[model samples]
Target: MNAARGGGSVENGIANFAPLAATVFLALVMLLPVGTGVANVMMPHFVLIATFYWLLRRPVLMPYGACAAIGFLLDLWLDVPLGLNMLMLLSTRLFILSQIKYLRGQTRLVQWLVFALFTLILYTLSWFAVALAKRDWLPVEPLFTQWLVTTLSYAPVALVIGRLRRVMV
Candidate 1:
């Protein structure tokens, strides 16, 4: 049976995977050595942005399990304490879901502001976690720089993801 005849279609099935695929791609890209020195410290959290965008725009396609999986993968790749990224990503999803009603219909500026606020909170938590894991206090400058860069990069990342969502999902 065809989609018009009330059966699942191939395109629909593939589209359902787009969010996960895009997110994983972004996560991999985050591992690339694209910057130097301060630029490296300022590297935006592309995976975080992608996860947030997909969760906000299409929650059904980007669920908690997927978030956990992506985080786990990143933690392994980055050689951080296992589950650090998973915890952060899961926390982000939970926070966004709780505020979805308020976030869904807002303007881009409003959304960006909320994202910035959340990113600040998330990075703070991350800093604490890393410090605890290493049994020593870490420098705040890199975390602060990353938080600012990631927050600022949200708009463009969202725009690109939004366009991809329209075309693929």
Candidate 2:
């Protein structure tokens, strides 16, 4: 039966979890080792990209609770100050939701531009939070590099997720 009939099916349940599962998989991928060099510095925020794409394309699948859970997991794994990633992700979801009316139907280029701006703000805020927690000002270059890399990576991530969204959701 269909959801409109107030009946749920196994297929519907699996489809609903696809986005969250994909995002969690991405989070695990982010933890894999990358050899030292510029590649390390330029590592894209995989979780952030997935979070953004899912939040934009399927907000219901990526609710605030899921975001918090993902962020908390990242924080524990990465060993950063607790709640930093949570704050960033929650802020991202809130911003996207607020702008959904304007963002919907926009071209990929426009979406990329918006993501760039949003990533910049997120990275800047994260940098400040880390610096404050450590009681020392942190270097800005790596954060800037990560922001650029993450922003640039959004298009491909979005494309893949968009396809998944169509097929699954």
By lDDT, the best candidate is 1
lDDT per residue as tens, model 2, 75-99: 9998999998888889989999999
Please report the candidate that would top TM-score against the real structure: 1
Give the 10-residue window scoring lowest on summed lDDT in candidate 1: 34-43
Total colliding residue pairs, candidate 2: 0
The local lDDT score (0 to 100) that residue 2 gets in candidate 1 is: 81
Model 2 whole-model lDDT (C-alpha atoms): 0.87
Q: Per-prediction count of colliding residue pairs?
A: 0, 0
Candidate 2 has its poorest 10 consecutive residues by lDDT at 34-43
